[model samples]
Target chain A: MNNHENTAIEFNQVSRHFGEVKAVDSVDLTIQDGEFFTLLGPSGSGKTTCLRMIAGFDHPTSGQIKLHGRDVTNLPAYDREVNTVFQDYALFPHMSVGENIGYGLMIRKVPKSERNRQVRAMLELVQLPGLEHRKPSQLSGGQRQRVALARALINKPKVLLLDEPLGALDLKLRQQMQVELKSIQHEVGITFIFVTHDQEEALTMSDRIAVFDMGRIVQTGTPSELYERPRTSFVASFVGTSNILSGETAQKITGSAQNISVRPEKIRLVAPETETADSFCAADGQVTAVVYAGMITRYTVALAHGQTMIVAEQNLDDVSKSVATSRGKQVRLIWPCSANNVLQDPE
Target chain B: MHYKNNHRPKTPKGLLLSAIGVLLFLHLPFAIVMLYAFTTDETTFTFPPPGLTTKWFGVAMGRPDLWAALGLSLKVASIATVFALLLGTLAAAAVSRSKFFGRESISFLLVLPIALPGIVTGIALRSMMGLVNIPFSFWTIVIGHATFCVVVVYNNAIARFRRMGDSQIAASMDLGADGFQTFRYIVLPNLLTALVAGGMLAFALSFDEVIVTTFTAGQQSTLPIWIFSQLTRPRDRPVTNVVAFLVVTITAVPILLAHHLSQRDNL
Candidate 1:
């Protein structure tokens, strides 16, 4: 009965081991109530496992899991007041959309008329106003996904655990759902613990993200903070893309550099003779490669000390002519010293 | 409509003829029975059935013994199918949902009754029943039939359970349904078609079963037993043909229905 109303979930030194494999190692985490938090990681990095633990599909091998400061490590999923939107949707193929959405209410013995009204309202909330009678198998993939969301949301649990719900949709449809999902969370005002491998999806939707690598959280911060000021090389490269400068090359760029990282977009490509102010860091190199993407162009510069630095520039100018001439030319990559983020080796 | 432009390999004419030949060889006896059920001849074999008449159908329907045997056969088949459905589904759930040691071996044993010879199963049941002092009766016959009927259901149930996966059950629990509620709402609906298909096949198998029923039904006559006993009487040939035709129809319909149900959901 220990109540911390503002804290939705807490994992205290939790570890989950599957025989010899440590799927989720000793980890301490807290997700604030009503916040859209994401666990970002590649496959097998324990993101989904962590989400499952929160939803009570999995239990910690040691330590504790608390929902609102009440220990729930030994509780089964049915006992926990949390719901999950599964990655596969997991909609019952035999049930129609309305039946699936109203299942939780039916279990609670809510009156039939009330259940139906709530189901219809949930369908509308998910933007699927008239698909209540269609079976899960009859709907398209995205429609099935919406039904799954509506089903979990109808119960109105304290927290919603989503395990890569947008992974199966097409890119265009995925982007659309991402916005819808964020808005739905905002409207519902329930804590959402989302797990995803896509960094852009995490950045676009989550209020804060915990980056996971090798069964541990590498860093946790706001999307902009994680992207701009990564604490480790793993977080720097994973959240977005960053060029890590270390050893002698880093030492020459910034005096006595143990390790430092700067984003590719942060460094500007200029003439080799460009003068650097005291507030800026500059490196002279030959442009070894030019990759012209639709929205941006990337230049790979080979420094005199043999370290390559990537510089990305927005395609604001007519860059097609410059793309042909940029390769093999001497260039100076310049960025304000504030753009450099000091890095630490991952544990 | 035009297969010549299709990329699939053309089916050879010889293969098609041989397939037809095999089907004819397999079903030609049933077609002969169908033809003779309407024969005018009361006794002896005759080509082309000599002439056709609907009298044997009426005659077969009039016999009290035929009705009694048919009723008993239906009763035994229905009861045996129910038993098979319950036991087989439990065994399938246990084997498919858990990872206990010897899971594979246990499932293998569950299906062994059907794989073994029917005579062997009959003898084993008879010995066990006698050892337990359980007198041979209608219930004994049902118990005997259910042994192999369970195997048919187990196969169907296990395959469907594997395809259904555990995600829906997990989803059910996460949505606040307890274990029994999850089974009733989530597991049962998903398993309905598979169970129906399995039960139908079990009914068909149990309906015309003679060997096990013969060993278990002491002094009683089921439809199959009556048909087997009538084969020795020359006067009852025409009536026997009609009854055989009825038996074939009764068993064939459910088998076909089971096949249809099982094949409908490949997705």
Candidate 2:
């Protein structure tokens, strides 16, 4: 009942059940206009199901789905003013790239000349110009991904849903596409609801993200907020690597009984003689394992009170040699008390 | 030197010989049939087909009854193939694209006509026609052939539908296409090659079918039935061989073409 002018999509306690299984449990969500929002979760966490419902490919078992304040719970996908870039690309195999990109306009009864012009423009916008004559099967994986993007974008939908469209690309191509996708969203100024299981991809591109677990949104926040102040243990562990300190171990460090989470990168390695400052929390431990990644090294420290914490340190200057050789050595791990994000127990 | 050795031909001699033996066993009978179509001697079995004159081919071509039967067989196969393609594709789409009660059982029933003995299907169709007082004619023959042809197309169409997946259809809809437009643009194009291959296979199946056609066609003769009757005559033996060769060619072309189309899809 709030003003819906700026709300691109609103799910009013939506739930989708497949007979006995609750694929998407009852959830309330709102996506603002022109925001690059992401639904992030592991497989079967209902991220894709949420995107499908928004696209009208799926219907909610209960509750209402509103698009720009209009009820579209029973509207078919074609009637909705939304388009999707599917994970498999789903390019029409028989059509050339030009035809695939122009299919939407053609369906809408656009003239052939105008449709072709728009297809060309879209192809260029996706950075895949002059390859329109080739069929989808003739293109490489990355090219096909671009073609799918162009095809959906040509329709000029009010909102665009991307369901792991970059999942099929190689590492280098995927990273490149991430930056390109963010720029495209900015250029179009269209509301984007992207679904991805890769939390890093969600963090790198999305303006805001909803972390889902077990058919429910565990948390929704900006990337920095979710990374810095994860409200639940699932959110703390899923969004990024966190050293979840709780129970007696948390009491010993923070003098509090509540569960807290500290990120691996937030903890610093210091000399054993270093004293804990009033504004900082410190734990005495022995370095048990060292993992040397290219840009960073992670150390597993077994605290004296019997819990283990992982500390990630950048391989900068002499820190790399020292941390790589720190196994079996006594160390003091300290971080600002502000870094200890208190968590509510996951239900 | 090492590279050349690694690249050396590695086909085993015994395996090659056995493969050649199997190929000859399967094809040598057809080669003899071809040779006898040009045999000069009639009503006699002779080694090497004494004096291959090509006279039987001319005689076989001149028969008005043979032409009538060939024309009828082609008409029946064409109509049956069309029926099979339509019904089979619809059945395939329903089974593959929807979730409903008894979907699996429906799929199992679709292929039952091809699985059961042809004589059993023939008898069943004949009895049903009798019970309904429906006259046996060209239409009955087409219907009988379609019963099994539908299975051929369904098998091909269903396999392709499953492999092609439903994502394309969903993509089509998400791109602002209604049900008809989605099928016309997305589903139909993706399904074209499969349907063509299936239709070709169905045509071949209906062309040479004998048992079912016999029960369905009352007072009518298709090419296979004509060949069956010609086999009883001793004087027209070489002529029958010529007609059989023509039938073999006609059926083999579509079957081979369908096989080639399907094989290309794998690449």
Candidate 3:
């Protein structure tokens, strides 16, 4: 671990319960001073519950949450030094954008002249300087999102929490905002705790991601670690698409080979007639289906042991000329022994 | 099953007869009173052979008793409406949004006075005030009207609060605002329209209320009570008609305005 003393936020075994249901169970995490950390999971997976606890909207049933080494476990939301951007952008419909952005400073009892200056600067930062007079209903979805960010950032809190902030945008706009959010975080240099159910969003925007299952975190790692070295089957299936195969672990056939896992893109297909006998980790299978995407082709192959494996090949050149016709025919799959990742089965 | 497949009559003749029956059931008494108000004869109900005159309108306007009653009714309604708006909104916010023991029971009891019969509430309040040894005055009448009027405001405020998601309040609190600041900046603006609509409705209901007002109000004559007393004495019949017409205009205008404001907010 890096010996950085600048820890912005930490949760020490925090748990929350509603009636008999434990919504969040024993979560422990540390967010660095200027890092963008994401809590990624599906619905009812405790990701939002964790984010709310950090924001002080929900108090933990047990354990504690600390901000800059101060215990804020039972602080009211208004007493905490954090701000949030909601999923629907939650802009005040009655106020103009200028008023909405300046609301936090006004509540802090800052002088009007200084508040106006900071509001203008934050508006310019979001690229919405001239549109301050418009109401939230008058703006497009993306513009409203930027105003929400500006409103939360104007307070200059110790940390910022965002709850599914881009869940309402279209796919194209969501991708564009992903870049904008990351760049804005870098520019502001404040710790950000973001919650999102979209796996791709977490992978794209976060410095590190904590993957949550039902009420507990399954894994937490950097993007590359999560993709290439998943320690559990849940992480492998959740981080990205993977075709799972179940079989008894055999003796190592190659150096350092235990149980084998091959990524879909790494697997190669060869025609049955021209197949060599020395192909590495070769498996014979019948082609069940072929899906033709524009940049790649995916084949669903059924092995002799009734396990289906998916293989994807990029179309570097004309795919028709590179391989013989094998849409319905049996084929052989091969991959390097080093490409397989061994992960423990899920409980 | 046979009832489900029976041929229902779709002719305009059947619909027209039902519509006329409903109209007659609702308006027959008002039509009779209006016809009698214009008659020149000083005797019991007679349909024909009576000349019409605008002289009674002038005489009704000249009476001091009617004007006094009208003034007292306006004061009571205004005071009751303001008190109901303040207390009702606070009660709604506390009961609807907070979690504590007996919260459901408190909400249920708050609406009980309005749900029960008006006479039952009036009698109950009369005995309660007597036990406390508080004499009936203008304040008593205002309190009586406000007890029921509060239900209207509380109901409207609670519904609006529910429709507005809790995220707006959370966002405001997160943005360095204290609890009161969040209430002022975020919660109050959203609640303004609902309160105005509910206030106007409460005012209208209090203005026309006579059943409970009759028991709680010992000597003060509100417009409805004044009209009721005038119905017993024949010399004041024409003035009662004039007062009734004016009451309809006063109550209808605020209700219509409140309806328009609520519809605008919905859009």
Once fitted onto the true fold, the runs of candidate 2 whose alpha carbons sit more than 4 angstroms away are A319-321, B1-10, B52-54, B123-140, B215-217
- Please give, for every candidate in the order listed, the TM-score of chain B alone compared with the true chain B: 0.95, 0.94, 0.87
Q: Enumerate the candidates' DockQ scores in order.
A: 0.79, 0.86, 0.65
lDDT of 3: 0.84
Ranking by lDDT: 1, 2, 3
Q: How close is candidate 3 to the true structure, as a TM-score?
A: 0.85
lDDT of 2 by residue, A61-118 (tens): 9989999999998899999999999999988887899999999999999999999889
Collision pairs in model 2:
none
Lowest summed lDDT across 10 adjacent residues in model 3 chain A is found at: A248-257
RMSD in Å for model 2: 2.7
Q: Higher-DockQ candidate among 1 and 3?
A: 1
Per-residue lDDT tens digits for candidate 3, residues A240-324, read 7775555532232233424445678878888764554454666678988887786888888987667778999998888774344
| TM-score versus the correct structure, for each prediction | 0.91, 0.94, 0.85
The number of the candidate with the highest TM-score is 2
By the DockQ metric, which is better: model 1 or model 2? 2
Tens-place lDDT digits, model 1, residues A34-100? 9999999999999988998988888889989999888899899999889999999999888899999
Q: How many residue pairs clash in each candidate?
A: 0, 0, 0
Single out the weakest 10-residue window by summed lDDT for candidate 1 chain B.
B1-10
Candidate 2 chain A, run of 10 with poorest lDDT: A316-325
